[model samples]
Target: MPVAAVALVAGAVGAGPVIAAVQGDPALPERTAEQLLADAVRAARSDPRPMSGTLMQTSSFGIPGLPQVSGAGGSSPGALLAGSHELKVWYGGADRIRLALPGRMSETDLVVDGDRVWLWESGTNTATRITAGREDLAGHGRAPGDRAAEALPTAATPQQIAREVLERADADTAISVTGDEKVAGRDAYQLTLAPKDEASLVREIRLALDGETLVPLRIQVYAEGSAEPAFEVGFTTVTFSPPAPENFAFTPPPGAKVQEKALADLVPGPVGGQEKGEELADGAEVVGEGWTAVAVLPFSEKDLRGLASQKGQGAGSADAGAAEAAVESLLKSAERVDGAWGGGRIVRTKLVSALLTDDGRLLVGAVTPERLVEVAGQK
Candidate 1:
């Protein structure tokens, strides 16, 4: 299984033992920071064993007046940015995986079975099928519904988050072995990474690596001057047993609206046409490196409206209106600021700063507002 194929899963039967393990601290031999870091990197790159587990993610960014749009429940993409969420995952390999986000009365599932991928939303009775060609299967080629899959809250996982943080680790990052810790009732070693730059809003990031397998079981990211984690994702219960073959089989619910998409449709055409990948590459650029890096992208009002409309379709008109209103409230709450680069509105949260320029450029990063303005001036 590829590293990207690795994610967390859930079952009450599997949760019992894990819950018992969390009660007492497990004793383990001490290891150096370098040893633990190397083990984590190796595990991430290596083929992972078949597993199933449940993951929980919590966020406390402290963005005031955050809207609670109707229909945006635990399965909604917007819900991932705030509050708490639980996800169940089953990973057989890179070619077979299932992620389920259970809501009070509805459930959303993303299943990749061989070359066919299915996204099922019980709330809306919608099923989207993405067919990947043999050539595209290895890389998981993008299709029209790729954006919809990207919106799934299951996209965030402990292994995924740990991989990204490890990629950003450099000389500017101070790495150390904090101590041994328990996660999901498993003995693990805790590794901490702290950025050297003062301008970055991130104070430190911590990862709990399983003792034997070295798979990341939990990750916590803290903002500068804050003791609580701004964002966190971790497995609560896990098992190494392979999921049943039946778990990968899916037949959309009867009467559900189904849409089919092909990879060829994602290809660009002639006459100034471009694919989504190319458009994003050409329109966005990253400034700086490591912790203080800022991403600059072109985002106009039209684009925002399109996003709102897309959310509305998945949800409903009333919820869509609330979404639009939320966007308006966010813009209104932003402070007007003028910099040497230009004038625009800036929004600051505990761990993120975003500047929407008058010229329709959006610069965002986990850095100080001053850092965002500095990067905007460079543009």
Candidate 2:
């Protein structure tokens, strides 16, 4: 099977101990990281393997300012995207894994034999041809072993993942060995793995195992350097069994574009000659023509309303009527004002629509720049 196929199964199973090994004492002699991982692999391999199931996956990122973005800071940053796949995997000496991503987007399939690889999505409006050789895939890099392999530790093995707690759990990193959890209603062990070091590559991982089957219910990944987790995934179902032979091959369509780009070339450097007006705060550089953009930190609608309301708050009874009229007029004017923090300026002419983020910041895109600068600089 191709490495990628294995990754899908791993995603569902968490890592290692495929078959239920006799549950040693909850507090048995802690094994080394290597040993624990090996057991996991053994358990996983020795099983009435899963035949087919759906695997749901999600990936996100941890950026300084772009907290909600997915993947690395420089990678794709869609706030949230989800995907699922119909998966079939067979694990023996050499495993075979297959994935049919949800949706009719594409029907690409990957197969692996030792290091040799085969990929077939669709070709001739039916099945595609095969390129049989490790050399054919050399430039592409190693194929993924399973879904979890990509989602789990940066470079983790079933053995390593199985005993992730035994190796990394420390005072700062508290590893929780839960009594038992359930995946697909199967009794599973819930192992909560956390990082002892703040700077560790992984922040935390939750492993759910089927106690009877010795398979994983789910595995979750979090921010690489945060106390709070940013993303999680769970397998609704899992089975260990072989798939149809056709699942391993790929055939491109007659006129399919076979363009391939190196990973290094995918990086986005500073885009020049263009001003990108996204979510700019205090120190974002102003961009564009006939305008300057400024961000008002700690600014709120209530504060603006309060300012307008103050027009009548200090008036005597006789003057109260005039003060109230003035306050109403000021509030009306404030409502008409609008702004946006993009196109290199905070348009402060008229209000279009106001955006409120999860964080207590208001994204007010306006229509005029001069007034925007003034508003941003307000005390």
TM-score of each: 0.84, 0.40
**Model 1 Cα lDDT, one tens digit per residue, 200-250:** 888888888888888888877777887677666789998888999888889
lDDT of 2 at 53: 57
Show model 1 residue runs off by greater than 4 Å.
Answer: 1-26, 68-72, 140-154, 263-280
Candidate-wise lDDT, in order? 0.69, 0.37
TM-score of 1: 0.84
Q: Which stretches of candidate 2 lie over 4 Å from their true place?
A: 1-51, 62-95, 113-117, 122-173, 199-203, 222-229, 244-246, 249-379
Residue 366 accuracy (lDDT) in model 1:
80
Predicted structure 2: lDDT? 0.37
State the lDDT at 286 in candidate 2.
32
Error of 1 at 196 (Å): 1.0
Clashes, model 2: 57
Residue 68 Cα positional deviation in candidate 1, in Å, after optimal superposition: 5.7
